[model samples]
Target: MSDEQGFSPRERRASFTLAGIFGMRMLGLFMIMPVFALYGQDLIGFSPLWVGIVIGVYGLTQAILQIPVGWLSDRIGRKPVIYAGLALFALGSVVAALSDSVYGVAIGRVLQGSGAIAGAILALAADITREENRTKAMAIIGVCIGISFAIAMVLGPVLAAFIGLSGVFWTTALLALVGILMVRFMLPEQAHRGQIRDVTAAPELFGRLLKDRQLLRLDFGIMLLHLTLTAVFVAFPLTLLDAGLVAEHHWWLYLPTLLLSFVLIVPFLILGARRNMNKQLFQASILVMMAALLLMAAGQGQLWLLALAMMLYFTAFNFMEASLPAFLSMLAPAGAKGTAMGIYSTSQFFGAFLGGVLGGLLYQQLGGGGVFVLVAVCMAFWFWLATGMTNVSKVRSHILSIGVNIENKDQREQLLQRLMALPGVHEALIIPEEGAAYLKVDGNIFELDQARRLINL
Candidate 1:
C-alpha cells in the first residue's frame, strides 16, 4: 500500500492519526467562536467584556503554556505529554459544560488553554517522518486544521441552536477524549527521543532568534493577523443578528463564504508558491483584509454587504495563514527552526488574547464600527511593515543523514565545504551532534543522486 514516493505504512499511519487528532482538537476549540458572542448572554454575570474574556481566555493560557508544554514533551516523551494535555483539555471541557456563569466559563477556558499540545504534536510528526518528506507530512496536518476551522464555523450555530452552548462544550469534551484514545492506540510509537531540528524548540537558541529582524517582522505580522481575527469574531455574531440572520441560519452564510474563500485562495497560493511571489501576495492579502474590514464597518446592517465582507475576509485570512508559516520555515536559521516556530506561535496566541480583550473593550465603548476600525488600523500598520520584508527564495529544505561515526570536527567541516560546492545548494549546515546536514536547495538545479551518494559514503 505504499505510495510511489516511498512513504511506508508506519509513516502514513502516524501522519493520518496525528492529523486527525489535531483536527479534532481544533474543531472543539473553534466550534464556539461563531455562536459565543450571542449565546454568552444566557450566562449569569455576562457582559460583552467577560464574554470576550471567555472566548479568548484560552488563547492567553495557550500563549503562556505552548512552549513549556512542547519543552515538557521533549523531556517526558511525546505520547505522555500528549496524553496529559488532552486529559486537561477534556477536564476543562467538562468544567465549561457545567458552568452557568461567565466567570466559570472563563476559568474553564483558561484550563483548556493550559493543555496546549500543538508543539508536542508537531514534534511527533517530525519524529516519524523522514526529512525529505517532513514538509509533506506537516502540510497534511495544516490542511486538516484549515478544513476543521471551516467546518466548525458552519456547524457552530447549528449545534448551538439544537443543544445549547453547554451541549457544545460537552461535545468538545468528548472530542478530546476521542483524541486521547487515538494517541494511545492509533499513533505509531517513536523509537527515539529528544528534540528534532525542524520540530522541537531549543532553549539555547532563543536569544539569537529573538534578535533576528526578519523573523521578528513575520512574528509581528502574525500577531496582528490573529488580533484582527479575534477582534472581528468578538463582534461579528452581533453583526449577523443585526442584519436579521438568526443564530440557527448563520451557518448558511458561513458555509458559502468559506467555500468561496477556499476557491479564491487556491489561485493565489499557487501563484505565490510557484512564482516565488509570496512577498507580493502576502502584502496584497493584507490589503484585501483591510478592505474587507472597511466594508464591514460601512455595511450598515445589510446582510448582502456583510456577506461580501466575510467572503473577502476569509479569502485573505486563508492566504496569510498558509503563507506566513512557509515564509517562517524559509527564513529560520538551520538548527533553530523549532525555536523560531515556538516564538512565532506564542506571538500568534498572545495576539488572539489581546485582540479579544481590546476588541471587547472597543465594542463596549464604540460598538461594532469601533472594532472594525481598530482592526483596520492594525492591518494598515502590518501592511507597512510587510512592504519592507525580504523576499524569500523559492527553495525547499532537505536533510541528509551523516553516519553516526562521523563525529570529527575536521571531517564535518570538510563535508560541509563539499556540500556548499554542490550546484543549487543555497545554504548548508552540518550539525555533528544531530548527525545530519541541513540544506536549502533549488529543486530544478540540485542533483539529488549526487548528493545522496556523497552522504552515503
Candidate 2:
C-alpha cells in the first residue's frame, strides 16, 4: 500500500489524466475574460449588464446541471458524459464566434456552460484514486485550474488583441476540439467503480449529505467564495476601463499581479502544512479577502489605491482557492465524500450566477464601488462563519474494504471494538450499506502488513 493518503501509483497517473482534462476545459473558459466584455459592448443588444449576463450565463447552466451530470456520470460512464460536455462546449464556442449579437453570445454561453465538465471530471477523479489519497488527486486538479486561470488571464488579452473577440472564441473552440482528441486517445476507458448511484440509494444519499453540518459549512464556504469572485470580476474589468486603461492593456495589470500572488501563495500553503496551521491560515485568508473588498470599496477613484486593493484581492483569492478543498477533505465524512464534493461544487456555480446578477445590478445603479460593497458584505458573513470553525488535527486514514462476519449489531460492534483496540487505530467508521470502513490511525504505528493481518487481509 502507498503511504500517500489519496492515490496509488496507477491512480496517480489517472489523477494527472483527469487534471489535464479539467485544465484544458478551464483554459477555454478563462480565455474569454480579457476580450469578451469590450468587444461584446460593440455588439447589438450589448450593455455592461448584458456583458455580465453573458459572462455568467454559462455558470447558471453549469450550476443547474452539475448534480444531474454527476449523477449521470455515476450511472452511464465518466468518459461518455465527459465527451458529451466537451463537444457541447466546443459547439457553443463556435456558435458564439459566429454570432454578431450579444443575445446570440449569451445563448452560446448557456450552451457552453451546459458542458458542466467539472462535476464529471471530479467524480472520475474520486473513482480512480484511493480514499486515503483522494485529497491529493483533487488538490492536483485544483492547482492545475489555478495555474491555468493565472496563465489564461495573461494570455487572453494578448490573444484577443492579435485575433479579436471572435478569434478568441474560435481559439476556445479549437482548445475544446483538442481536449476531445485527448479524451479519445489518451485517457484510459476504465469503468469507474462507484460511478453509478442506485435510484434506491438516492433518498438516503441526499438526506444524509444534507443533514451533515460539517459538509453544510464547507458548502456555504464554497458558495461565498465563488460569489465573491464572480461579483468582483463583474466590476473589475470595468474599473480598469474607467481608470483610463483600455481592455487590451488590462493584462499589464493582471500579468504581474497574478505572478506575484502565485509567489506568495506557495509560502502560506507551506506554512499551513508544516505548522499544522491550516485552520488559522484558512481563517486569515477569508479575513484578508474581506479586507480587500472593503479596501476596494473605500479606494474608489484613486488609481494607486485600486492597484493595492487588487494586490490584496488576488493574493487572498489564490490562497483560499487552493486551501478550501484541503479544508473540505479534512471535514467531509468519508462515506459521503463524493456527494459532499458534488454539493459543494454545485453551490459554487450557483453562487457564480447569483454574484453575476447581483453585481450587474449593483454596477448598473452605483458603478464599481457598489460591486465592491456587495462583495465586502458577503465576505464579512464568511468571516463570521469561519471564526467558529473547529481546528482539525490531521490524522492518517485509509478506506479499507474487508469481508466481515457481520451477523448482528452486537457482532458489528464487537468487531469495531476489536479494531479500535489495535495499535495506532484512531477512529473507525463502517457503513453496512456502503460496504466499507474508514479508519484514522497513527501512520507509524499501523504498518500495512499489520493492518492486513488485523483485517485478515
Candidate 3:
C-alpha cells in the first residue's frame, strides 16, 4: 500500500502523464494568444472585433461547461470525461485548421472551449496520489502548464512565421490527439475507492461556498488575473509595434522576460514559504501586478521600459497563478477543495472572455495604454480585497477512508468526535455512506498515523 513516505510508482505515472496531457492541451490554447490577431488579418472578414471574439469565445464555452462537466464527471468517470473532452478539443482544432474565415475560426474556438476537462484532470490527480503528496503531484502539473504557456508565447509567432495560421491549428489538433493517446495508454487505471470529497466537487456544497466572502475574493482575484492576462495579450503587441519593435522580434522580448520571471520568482516563493508569509507575499504580488499595468500605461512607445514592466508583470502573474489555488485550498473547508476550484476555474474563464471583450473595446476606443490603465484599476480593487482576506498557513487537507463498521448515528458521532479531538486537526467531516473522513490539519503537528489508527483502518 502507498503511504505518506513517498509517491508510489502509480502516483509517479499518473502525475507525469497527467502533466503531459495538461501541458499539451494548454500549449495548444496558448499558442494562439500572441499571434492570433496578426494572423487573423489574413482571413476572410478579418477585423479587430472578430479577432477578439475568436480569441475569447473559447473561454465563454469553457466557463459555461466547467461546473456542469465537473459535476458530470462525478457520476460517470474521470477517464471517460477526459477522453470525450480531448476529442472535442481535437475536433475544434480541425475546424479552425480548415477555416478561411474569421467567423469559422470563432466557431472552432467555441468548440475548443467545450472540452472542459480541468476539474476532471485535477480530480484524477488527487485520486491517484496519497494525500500527503498530492500537492507535489499538482505542482508537477502546474509546472508543466507554466512552461507550456511560456513556450507557446515564444513559439507561436515562430510557428506562424513558418507554417501560417492554419498550420498552427493543425499542430494544436495533433497536440489534442497526443493528449487522447496519453489518456488511453499512459494513464494508470484508478483503483475503485470511496468518493474522494477533498478532490471531487460536491453539488450539495455549492450554495454555501458561493456565499463565502473569503472564497469569492479569491475567485474574483483569479478572474482579474486572467482578465488582465488576456487583455494584455490582445493589446500589448500593438504597444510593441508602436515602440518600433517588429512583430517577429517580439519573441526575444517574451523569451527573456518569461525566463527571467521564472528565475526570479523562485527566491520570492521560497521566502514566502519559509517565512510563513502567505498573505503578505500574496498581497505584495497583487501590488506588483497593479504596478506592472500602470508601468505599461506610462511606458508607451518606450521599448526598454515596457520590457522591464513585462518582466514585473509576468513574475507576479506566475506567482499568483500558482499561489491563488494553494491559498484557496488552504482556506477551503475539508471536503470542499474541488467545488472551490470548480468555481475558481469558472471565474477564470469568464474573466478571459471579459478581457477579450474589454481589450478589443478599449483598444479601439482608448488604445493599448487605456487598456493597461483600466485593468490596473481592477487590479487595485483586487489588492484591496486581498488585504482583507485571511490566510490559512501550513494547513493541509486529507481524506481518509473510515472503514464501514459504524452501525448507528451514535457511533458515527463518536467517531467524528475522536477524529476532531486529535491534536492539530482544525476541521473534520465524516460521510458514512462514502466511508471517508475529510480533515484539515496543521501539517507541523498532525499525525496521519494517529488518524489512521483512530479510524481503525
Q: Candidates' TM-scores?
A: 0.97, 0.88, 0.96
Question: Which window of 10 residues has the lowest lDDT sum in candidate 1?
Answer: 191-200
Task: Put down candidate 2 lDDT per residue, 1-457, tens digits, no spaces.
Answer: 5664535667877888778888988888777765676667778887767767777677788888887887777678888889999999999999999999988988888888899878778777766666556757867888899888887888888888889888888988988888888778877667765442211123347778888776677788888887777777778877777777788788888887778888887899899877888778888888888888888788776666677777788899888877776666556554455566667777888887777777777888888888898778888888788777766556555666556735467866776777778887777766664555667666657664565566663
Question: What are the RMSD figures for all models against the true structure?
Answer: 1.4, 3.4, 1.8
Local lDDT at 53 for model 1:
79
Which 10 consecutive residues of model 3 have the lowest summed lDDT? Answer: 191-200
Pull out the clashing pairs in model 1.
none
Instruction: Residues 42-85, candidate 3: write the lDDT tens digits.
Output: 79987666766777778999999998887677778789999999
Ranking by lDDT: 1, 3, 2
Evaluate residue 370 in candidate 3 and report its C-alpha lDDT on the 0 to 100 scale: 90
Candidates sorted on TM-score, descending? 1, 3, 2
For candidate 2, the per-residue lDDT at 267 reads 91
Q: How many steric clashes between backbone atoms does each model show?
A: 0, 8, 0
